[model samples]
Target: MNKPLLLQAQRPFTAFAVRATPLATLCLVALLAGGCASPSYTITPEMQARAASENPAPPKDDDFPAPGSAKWQQGAFPSLEALRAMRTGMGKDQVRGLLGFPHFSEGLAGVREWNYIFHFRTGAGPDYITCQYMVRFNADVLTHGMYWKGAGCADLLKPPPAAMQPVATVRPTVVAPAKTTLGADGLFRFDGRSLDDLLPEGRRKLDALARDIRSDSGSAGAIRVTGHTDRLGSKPYNQALSLARANTVRDYLVQAGVPAQRMQVQGRGESEPKVHCAQARRAELIDCLAPNRRVDIEVLSGQ
Candidate 1:
């Protein structure tokens, strides 16, 4: 081989050795530090909230409020009167009127059951402990209800009276329902379902009806309003619309002097139609089905 060729090969070897020396030194340093290095971190509420936004966090037993917190009291809870009003075979609307909505509406075993959360003091130093109330339904009718197992549910039911009252020998009041049915067309425009949708004549009629109800009943008692819709929409949609309409009427009645405790509302949807529309698809079909869309109001006549 020529001497110049030998020099050319030697130059490449020198450069490689220089590059390898630095990389080997770095590897040695890293290996030495790896054994003694310790890392620590703090997680703040900000971090927790960020993590929550990225993933669903299931509720924990620890989520129960601390003792003496505002939530520990009976805020937004079913009252004693509501609990007493509940009865077997009552409709969903009636139950809702008694206890408001269930606390946990994500019913177990499908949509046939509902769970309500409540808290009560045990005086045993447990503070306001959490409990559950459960109700089961068959179709739209209530079947039964249950209290949280082993949670002293019965004790809360008949709590000790705050004070004693002199026993009075007086007859109890008796109340009966007086039903009234009104056509929806007179109250609403087409498919409207809000208080704002009340026609002028409808307002007058409702005012008169409210007066009649108060006069006929002699006292403001339990009021029940059931809303209906024509068979022109899906069941779920019609049900929701009918419920909205019923709520509107209920609110108006309450504003007009009916006691909220005495009011219950239901949405019958297209289930109880007064007349059947023929198969001919015409404008007349909707008008012919008008009788199906209506509201039924019932007030308790007291004695």
Candidate 2:
């Protein structure tokens, strides 16, 4: 009835289908490429079991119980029954097998004694008392064993209650300034002041003295450095030399941590004679007068 009109209507629908075909093909290509490039993931039973079985490494010493603790004692020291079983005829290797390693083995080359150290806690704090099991051996065979209990270990059976425990009193160490007299011969080369002029022995001694003074300087007060010369040099020259030497000593002390304000330099040239030598001119006489040439270090009260 209307063939030409029906054919004309189908023409527009066919043209629309043709335009959408290229766009659909591009989308399909992108989807297929993405699927090919991506890797698929799946967990097998073996992989799940391996993941469940994997464990972190055991803890090291830093993770173990602190030293001198009950956990430490249990982990380190052997039981009392093991010590009791140690007979006089047990070989060194046998004893080691039962007790593990000794904490300290003394006189190994000459004497045969193994010391096992054990720590015990008496209070809530971390402080612990040490107990040693000393075993003596004759030619590597156990001869006798003894238990040496330390200070607090004696009361192991009945640890004193915290209230009843004898409180340890730590007394403040009183460091007094010592008056140390050093011979002048040991310090300088004859009558020199520069550190280069000091003998090696004298330098060592001075350094040691300076270290001691500096170490205890917290409790040290004024340091008096007095220099004395022999009766050989002129009074003016002796005084000047003595003062120079005293100044040198003061400088060294300052460099060694002693405050500059804490030092007092004086030249008591030939004023103090430790040894009285009669008038003589031989080398022996010169040596006899050596005690007069000296330096005196006096450490006064602390600030």
Candidate 3:
């Protein structure tokens, strides 16, 4: 009789256990579904207003995920050029290509907004400003708008002023001497005043001078060629010889590529002596007066 009573009690307990199993299973399924559901990424009217605002307030907790959360990504240090390149109607991938992954929990797909914590240098120095940036997307997931939390942060995307930009170092141009002198004795045969009298050494020297003048043609201006003679001949005769020598030198230079229009010829005979020799011998006098008999070339710079 006691065994029968115990069996009756066991039947009730088994019935209760069977009923609880289905309820427990249903609860487990419901919990799993809730946990696996994706977060809503809808952009509300309020969010749009804030995004449109020229000066929006800083974001609150609702605007971003908690730090260290599963969706929170540490922000990046983006280049100013890249940030400036951002434009409306850019696809999500293109935006991501420039500024790395967004710094908030907003998922890549089915999301209409992305937030960032960007660091920008204030100047060339190490000092930087930390600003919150937001990129809003349309229903198509293409970027439609952008906003900044800090004042003047948007200005960072613009190019700096001309004065604020780095100035290139400009080295001053070195000007060559305006006047150059060459010995007539080195330029021609003794008592020679024509182009035919030019020695091989004289031709070579003139060639080099032509090359130099051509190299500086951009700055070279008027060129004056003057000839001087020693005090051995009559003033009138010496003057004519000097003038002939000046004309010959100018003509030779013109053939060597110097512009004839830029050259002017002059003769200063038996004047402007560099040395007054007291020597009695004719050779000594000629040698001492050699410095006075020469051609002077003057170049005025265009600058």
Candidate 4:
């Protein structure tokens, strides 16, 4: 009896060893030692009944872990690619390859259900939302059904819409500046300088010009109506007469629907001549200088 003396342990140490340990802790230790086998849970009818109930509570007996429990709290931040890789009929190992182990305490082997907590980015900086996901297995333990606890969470797993293409802009057409010459003889009576003195042909030509201007109004710019005379009258008198004739033509054009603001009038009495007559006879000179007495209308294009 003296040779077999009992070994005495400290009272504090004995109390620490007597505390109850969780089954998960024992399984974890066995797994580390490579001696633990994957466990299977028999799905009792009562368990199925509870799962099918409206507003069912968190499952007990290792069916489902309560929210904020140690197993449920172990969440993962999975990428969009990983979430998209999940599909039906995948084996437990394949599912585990993409999304790690279940966040809940469901065993690894022969598990009919796996629940997880996944965090997804909201695409607004670093903002993210936590979602609960569940995967159900068939009798062969292959994945068959997937579900989400939150509304709109499933939509996040789908791809985004395509980008829009830009449209080209069209430019307006611009007509070049053009100059038209009208004989004063055709436009008015001899020595005419007023609207009353305008000949019928002159009024008709002016009407046609107005129509052209109106048709190109969108691209039409400034219009210049210039009057020229033959070298027959005094410089000042010719100048005044030319100016008056130009004004009359411009007024007629305005009344014919050409914009008044876009038109300007000028007179160049005996200044610019198209032909210089050498004839000495008055009638011959008048006829020869006919080209010099005329009205020039120049229309400019839009900028």
Show model 1 residue runs off by greater than 4 Å: 1-177, 217-221, 301-303
Looking at model 4, the pairs that clash are none
Cα lDDT, all candidates = 0.62, 0.60, 0.70, 0.70
lDDT tens digits by residue: candidate 3, 1-303: 899999998999999999999999976554342222233345433333222222324455466544455243445678886786675445656777788666655642366777778878778998887777888766545566777776778767644322322435963444435777889999999989777899999889887776677556356588899989889877766776676678788877776767676888877877877878878999999999899999998887766
For every candidate, C-alpha RMSD to the true structure in Å: 18.0, 32.0, 32.2, 37.1
Candidate 3 lDDT (Cα, 0 to 1): 0.70
lDDT of predicted model 1 = 0.62
List model 2 lDDT by residue over 52-166, tens digit each: 2233343332432233533124335355445544544345556666776555323223445555666655479887665655555543233333344445442353312223224
Return the TM-score for each candidate structure. Answer: 0.44, 0.41, 0.42, 0.42
Candidate 3 wrong stretches, greater than 4 Å = 1-177
The candidate, 2 or 4, that scores higher on lDDT is: 4
> Which regions of candidate 2 deviate over 4 angstroms?
1-177
lDDT of 4 by residue, 4-70 (tens): 4433446556666665456657768544322122444454323322222223233332443455863
**Candidate 2, residue 2: how far the Cα is off, in Å:** 99
